[model samples]
Target: MSSKPSRCVVLFTLLAVAGCTSSPGKDFFTETIDSLHAKTSPLRAGYSGPAAVTSASNAAQRFNGAQYQGTGQFVSSGAPVTKVTGDGSGKFELNLVNAPIADAAKAVLGDALHLNYIVDPRVQGTVTLQTSQPVSQDALVDILQSALAVNAAGITSRGGTYQIVPLSEIMASTPPVSVPSTSPSGPGVKVQVLQLQFIAADEMKTILEPITRQGSVLRVDSTRNIITVAGSDSDLNAIREAVSVFDVDWMRGMSVALHPLKTSKPEAVAAELDSIFGTKEGPGAKLIQFIPNDRLNSVLVITSRPAYLARAATWINKLDRLAETNESQLFVYQIQNRPAKELASVLSSVLGTTVKTEGQSGGSNVSPDQTPIAMQSDGVTPAPLTGPSPSLPQQDNEAPAHATVVADVENNALLIQTTARDYQRIEQILTKVDVLPTQVMLEAVIAEVTLNDDLKYGLRWFFENGGTKVSVTDVAKAAAAATLPGFNWSYATDNIQVTLSALSKITDVNVISAPTIMALNNQKAILQVGDQVPILTQQSQDTGNGSAPIINSVQMKDTGVILTVTPRINNAGRVMLDIQQEVSNVTKTDSSDIDSPTIQQRKIQTRVLVNDGESLALGGLIQQNNSVDRSQVPILGDIPIFGNAFKQKNDTIRRTELIIFIRPHVVRDINEAREVTDEFRGKISLQTPIQKRRGGTKLQQDLKRLAY
Candidate 1:
């Protein structure tokens, strides 16, 4: 029994410990106290503090999650026949229907609600509504909302009361309210009266009234030009902002007129305007629709912002100025052989502006009120009296018939329009394009190849029958006597000699100088005469001294010929040609010891002027080719053994002549060029056709017999 009692005591102790463990301690309680103190301290010091609560009191400011600033009844579609009643708890109710919505609502809810209703005497429709069973107040309100027009009336409750009235009546009867001038916050409805001097009061009312709700009242006094509005501070501030955009002197209606210089049709101008301003979509919380004007090219800027009108005016004025300049000055020109489309492109490229063209449409050709003439039959031509005719009457300051004219391009002509000052410049450019190209005649003769006089096998036989070795010195001495002064030597030889008399010997090779020729269509061009003419080489002594060994230096010389010419055209389409020619004979000498090349040149030059289709001949260019051959006499020449007997030598010389011919023709027009081409074609045709078969003529048969 004692043991059982001890077990019971242990169980009791465990229960106590468990209970103690489950409960909070003094530290946790102290923390809670500290937090309470921190949160309450501000409230005790007379500040509202953060919106929270330890207890609810009339003086304590607390915020509930589901709450609103003011009390209000709800309505939709300009009616409140269905009541909207709600408590702080989430419960609501609705009542009677089948009557004027605003009147029934006012009777049930009283003045607590703000109602805005405008009575249209012309409107006679009645709203009928019924419910089969009880429903939430929201359902009843929704039913009423579906039956009435929102623009006519509405119901709103504030300050713990409900009211209903016509939208227009409420807007007019509500007391003026105030809103903070700078801050758009705080409690209560605020009213503001703004007197607009520039914007019409009616217009401001139209813009503001539609956007305000039942809680907001907007009134306009046309005579005083003032706007009176009342609403929640936020709603009132919004209305004020909207008014600010259009409350300006320019907003009344700004118009700008532009008269383009070219008098474009109204439709065309309208298209241009549409291209610029474009479409925009609004008024008060809605899109401003853009409507295009079909009657005029002018755009009606139906916007409340002045800047848009100003910007559009600036663009239109700029376009107008351009049109003015385009029309103020005019020029017309006729060009042949150029199409209108092609000419327009050329003008656009050259002038950097748009150019338009029309198909060869002939312009006006009316004679100004001409006198009547009697008709004559029989196709008889009237004969003029063989005497001076009387002078006709002349009108004062009247321009001649030819003075004023329009474009006519039926004869393959281009009609051009430009400023008066640019007319001459454009004319010159067209003339250059249309004028016939100048024909240049050229004549040339390529003379013989450069001379190479060295031995074919580097061995020179002095005599054919010597049959014995000859010293190179003796052979060099003999060749030196016959060598021309300008001939080059391959091997350097001591005691070399050249005869001055050889230089004076006139060869068949013609020498010439470049021509100083000039030609001009209108003005003379810079001449290149005598610029590249070859110069004759002067004689010089060798720089090497007679010593142990000597090195010969090489020299450079100019070779070949140059010719220059110019043609001048006269009024009669005749070309006078000036010509110059230069001829050169050059020789180059090189030795193994020389570091640089040697050259020498001899020149003959001449100049003359000739007419078109004339020929100039230069006859003095002649070249020579020389060669020597050796053979044994008959059988002795062919025998390998003792074959050196009776050797013989033969020398040969060949000469060539070079000549040049030139001709030129001046063409004035397309017809002239075509005629020349046709004549040449006729000649070709004559040589192409086969003739009828026949026996050969006497001259042809004789030539054939000689060939056989």
Candidate 2:
């Protein structure tokens, strides 16, 4: 490539790092707790409130120990800990052989993570673990504990510090049972309970097909198991009254087998799903692991019948195509692989609902009369399902024609990955999605994409496809009526979903689009009061503040964040000629305050809203959150004021956000701003400078600005 093109490429590369292209900044805890290295900023500010404290209760609630503990130790100091024991009550206890080491660990675990030593369920006496200081092990304290403290993967402990609730107590609490394992029995619509187990929140879905065998079908009273339609009773038989039904053939069975619940209770959650939805005329549903954070609380869905999974897959294929953009800049990002136990976390984030999972493999079934946790196989169990779990089907050379939603419920995840060739289908579905009654004039598109840290090019297209007309009623109706092959009409009306765009466009960032739909799962509070509720996207900002992007480097001349030096390549050496300077600029922000005559002029612009609700003052700069709003603002950057003696000017974008890029040294006092522009991935080049102060031989006595 020519030097000119190369320079453009270089500048563009640098801009990607320093632009307004990232998801909304992360919450304080997520960054602080998940950061790998220990940081010491005593005055670092973040949120602290009842909600934040309560929001953190998830980890403690799941284990349900009297006192949950997380331990940390210095790797350099091998501290020994012992004397672990549990009182009759449920408090954990442990002693650290070294106080300093224990204190260091205490610092790492903090209030949320304190190591609690408890009696192991399987082991008798006590065991002490001296763990290294807690840090991000895949972004979790538990994961960190496992990697450094417990010394195990995929294993959780119910600490030794508290009193143990005997397994015998949990069983004795159940009612007495009489039936012993029978060797042989007479066949009469033979039913057998082989095994049952508790499943996590996500695995709690069942797909049952109504029995089609002409003579094999049985009808029973709705309230009791008394078979009224035995094979012999064709007349006046209670057989036809079967309120609930099932087909062993249509069940695809689960993909990853779930372990039986730790409890011996017989009534597994899986059986209930089938009976409730498997009943005649019942709407079959699946437990989608929408929230993957808390396993204790999860959501259950009355989903489009199992038949709709096929159609949903086809539609997803089309969406995957729309997400495909320039290969030069890919934004597909996967931060962490959550576990099945984290299903509730994913569900919570996606659907904003409470959900949980519970089940086990090869466990006996639970009965209606018995406790919900009862374990007895006397009742005949539904034959386990069989077939291939849902996946992208094989095709020849062309792209796929379907969409598939893959949920790792056990792992608490739902990944929507689709191939190319479904863009037209996606567009068609989007255009027709009038799912709700009152239309929500979308003011923002929150395009979310995962960009490589290299920041060359990540996601570009904001939520341009959003902010268009979408109807909730249509989407729900379609979802309700949707079936396989023609899943088109099914979900377009009801499910009303948007595809994952590598760089999905957010066209409008108006303030009125409140309680906007996210994940097609936001079931409540659709429209916001336009006047009372200001849209985050609609908030205005000035070029002086909002415009200081993460540049390769920049200098302030009483204006916005403009490139102080342009990229140029040396023809002789082919090396990039960059000069990263720390300039001290002192200039008046407003035209009225004409101070510091050394500072020249400030450049600004006013753009009219060509498209309705567009900007006239705040050029291309987003005034609100970047995540929830789409990219509609156009960025027309700045130029330095020459001669360094003129007055600073105003951008005159009326009633919009105003930004002023003060010299770096000027804003070292503002912690937040400093954090915003630290080491913004730009390089500074140096050539030659000579000054002989202490009688030393110097090459030349001047500075040189190289020419391209």
Candidate 3:
């Protein structure tokens, strides 16, 4: 009994120590109770005014924080919360925190402007907004509407009252949408009519339906191909911009269009397209067709889908370019400034084909054996063969691979049966060759100068001056210098008239001819300023028995100054002239047999290169030592010293030199050619009046002399 009592006492002592160690602290237990109360307690209602507080006895019955509640209530601290505030100037301020959207809008519109409003029961959402400054009434309404829109609600003014409704019921509650004569204002619903050009109205409506608002309406008028949308201004504008992108030619579907060709033929292009996008049959095959309108030079495209049309249009644009290559086409190219036959020959040579004239015998590539023969009139006679028999293999040659070029003389066009690539090359060559040739105006002056003591050597010596470098070259020397042959002497000068004028001052200088003529490049021009002399070629012998011997023959020959010049202009504007000039005259009639006239002729034929507007002088045709006799009396002229007083005897020597000056001017354009023509006209007009005045004076002198 004693041992058991001792063990019980020890166990009791240990249990008391363990209890003391596990006990909770006073501060921690208090914090735990406060936290549990704060978490589980109901929310306290905010005090607004005296009405929010119950009667004093009722508040005393309700549990207070620490003691009995008093009658006065505490107002919240810091800035006072105002759902909406206005400055009476159409500007308002709002401080809403999770407030109902309807109450928020009513506070802004009704409390500020005293406006009536109706809020739908379905329009339920809280808006949180806190403005730092005042905003316009329209801006405040816009903010409210945007907040409403985010919650699938919208607001519209109807009958002078704001109606806040769900987006699904906005159109039903508001007035019917109409096309506004002007732009709609203030975030209200609007109506717009969009006319589609390429896409159908119903098709565009399908595209816009997904992005359209729930309250908006998209109506299509198929007959007019127009879509009418009733929505907000923003939505209408977005639809308009989208329609512009989708309603284009490239976006067309199941349509027909015409594309005109500029450089390529429509038939050939259509054929090429047929080879590319060929016919297809079955489901999902592209429905496309190309038809060529040859008369209008246009192609018609028919397609069933926009994608196929866009693909075909891209190819059409590529193939219809200027000078696009193609297969064979029969094209009639109008010959502008060249002969069709000559141009055809040039084209044939360049393209390696045979030329065919309009009415030539073998104009076609068809062989004689291939040509169909006509039946004979009689039944018994067999049809005649158009060519040799088949036994002759040499005559039965194959037709040429390249078609011949046919020349249409009547129209002055070439009928080319060739590919577009070859025709493009041919066109380039034709543009170069078939143009107006350059024209050159050649002016020549032929003068005969009676040499005096001052000009003893020649005109060359007279023309040479200190300021000018005159190169006097004889025929042999000119040939050695690569100058023109057949000219006796050549010299270059700036002005040939200056030398002639100076020579005329000392001696007689007679201008035989001054001729000016215009000739095309590589064409000949002739100028004759003298008479045609009849020459007796044969003399009639007195026949022993004849009545009057018939005069045999007389031939007419051109005499005096005659010039023939052929000018060739190079690309560098230099002229190569092949000139043949002749100065011939009947010196005297011979008293010998046939009484033929003796002719003195001086001719020069040569080729020379001269720059445009430069002058070339050709000379050295001289007659020297010509003696003239004068006698006062026949017997006294031969007598010695005393006879000199009785009769004067004089022998004069005459010397004459012929000089020709040539100058060529190249006329580049019509303006320059007109200027040259006007200058020549002025010169002729001046000379005509001068000649007339001289003739009148001479006539008056002759009349006065006759009267005397």
Candidate 4:
């Protein structure tokens, strides 16, 4: 052999050895195909042939990790690769004649590339391509995708393998609920399972499906009564806790029965229950229902939880206790101020209860013969009493009355028996009656005024009717006569020293003037009188004569009094008045002159308690008497004394008296006060009598006017 041929042969042998080592054999390809086919084997039954074909292509691409760049043969009859070309422009040429897609991919990519087929077992399609052009792996994928579009085919790579799937299936699958985690769970983090009993499979899916994205798996079985969850410790714990609320049917409820007490009515109890657990406003109507029994003797409470039923039962018990308290007790009232009969009348009218008076006449009782016997249940009439029937029992017919008042008129007491609730109402009514109209007490003073004869005639007081002033020209003769001892010149000088004391029933102060109306609630009066009086005091002064009287200082005398009165009203609508009265008087005594005149004062005071409209009269005061004398001569003395001849002697006596009156009225309200004051407000004015027209008779006027 030649050396050149031997070198070429050795080089060829090295290249063949490199090719055999670098490129996989048919067995490697077969193994790759088997792996891909196994991965996509499940999809073949569910997907079309084209879909399986696309999956197999993806499987090969994923395993090889290389993209097809040039012409690739698919489904042609010839060697796996008839032509191959490579250039730096990313361009290649290859011929695949009558070969499957797997071989075509291997030829196009490189001699070292391996192709795996994962097509459907039933598929008959093949790849045949002869081209010289620059093409990308994606372009080849696009061509395959177009062919598989009719069958709704898709591909997915996982675990270094491609799986075939229908396009519709790919589109229909939902995105993961949560993103998968890249880092592994820490130590002590273990997968846990949560089982749901009451929740439906679909609902559990919706609630826990989100954990799938966080590397958790939720396995639900509709046929089973439980749901299984697998996840990390923390995630599984969270899901288990959240799903517990939904594990039990909260809509399912329990029922409680109740019996009505004696004091409580079924309808009333039902109303209260409704208020607490409303049909529409509280906790969803379907969760609570109040169903009354047919006889209304019991009530059924339907509630979602036992707690609700317990709360309702507590309220019902409280209401029943209150009602029972009101019904079981008795009330009694002892009235001291009001008369028994009157109180009984008030009780009957206000409370609508019958009242009985002690020592009252009894009604006639029916004889046993007149009374009919009740028939027995066996249709036999009961026999009458054998002996004469005693007088009917005192309380025989009182059973039907709610209350009975035993009125003792003599002792003025009322013993009552009634319910406690009724007593409250009775008390209120009594308060109003106690404030009925009250009367006022009245007190008055009457006095007779009299003047001493010494002052009346000796002083020769002048009157307004006619002045009687004596001339002093005759004073000298009178003075000479008065100077004689034991001469009777003064008229009754003993009476001048006498002082008439006033009766002890006069008051100087007055409160609440007469003709005033006051309410019965407030009835008290205060009176005060502060009157000023001038008095002349006798004083010794230096005069011409020793110890002679002269004008001295003038003094003021306090002749005023004060009175206060308070009235007590009784239940009889009458008033008892407590009165205190005082009076002061200053009287002037006869003296030599005005400056030497003596003054004396008298005070009258009294206290009396009397009934309404009662009168208090005061008397025994000073009196005054005056007389005038006149004389006339007969006609024979008609000369200078003729003026007195026509007159006859005559004496006239005059008397004067003082009297005071007081009256009071008690009113209940403003309207009553107004009516008392306006009692005579309405008056008819006096009118002139109408005169009748007499110019014509009735017949004459009728005849004249009747002319057509």
By lDDT, is 1 or 3 better?
3
- Please give the distance, in angstroms, between residue 422's alpha carbon in candidate 3 and its true position after superposition: 2.2
Query: Would you list the C-alpha lDDT of every candidate in the order shown?
Result: 0.40, 0.25, 0.65, 0.42
What is residue 71's positional error in candidate 4, in angstroms?
A: 52
lDDT tens string, model 2, 1-708? 234445445444533443433336863333323331232223336735224434333323222111113355336555454433334343334443443323323432332234443322442222233334432322233222222222211112222221122222322222122112431221112221211122211111121113322322223332332331212112112223322222222234422222222111113233333454442335433422111112422112223255533433343333323335211111111213333224323322322222222344443233221111111123433111111223223222332222322334433333322322332222222223312212111112111122222211211111122333432112222322232121121111111122211112221111111111211111121222212211122223456886755332223332212222112222231211111112122433455442222432222221111111111111112122132222222232222444233333333221111111101111112363344334221211344342322111221121011010
Candidate 4 lDDT over 586-670, as tens digits, reads: 4455545453334332323332233344333322223244567866565544557566567766676643322222333445555
Q: Model 4 misses residue 565 by how many Å? A: 3.3
**How many residue pairs clash (N, CA or C atoms closer than 3 angstroms) in each of the candidate models, in the order given?**
45, 124, 0, 21
lDDT value, residue 518 of candidate 3? 96
Residue by residue across 192-228, what tens digits does model 1's lDDT show? 7777868898888878777866444456788988887
Candidate 1 weakest lDDT stretch, 10 residues: 495-504
The candidate scoring highest on TM-score is 3
Ranking by TM-score: 3, 1, 4, 2
> Residue-wise lDDT of candidate 3 within 1-708, one digit each (tens)?
334445445444543444454446543334433433554445459855344756655443333222223446467443544668777777888787777877787776677657788888888888876788999876676677667888887776677777778777766764445544455565555566666888888878787778766535457899989887775655666777778877887634467878877667887778777777864544434567888998887888887765766777778888877444443566678988777767666655544344433345745453322211111222333211112323212311222223335677667777766556555555665666677778999877787778888778766566554322334333333552354333456765566666555556677777667677898888789998788877889767678857876766889888878899999999899888888889888866756666567778888777877789777777777876556665566777557886776674467888888778888989877898998887666545343232211111123221211111
Per lDDT, what order, best first?
3, 4, 1, 2
Q: What are the C-alpha RMSDs, in order, of all predicted structures?
A: 33.6, 55.8, 23.6, 28.4
TM-score of every candidate relative to the true structure: 0.29, 0.13, 0.42, 0.26
Off by over 4 Å in 4: 1-433, 437-524, 529-560, 566-576, 584-617, 620-660, 666-670, 678-708
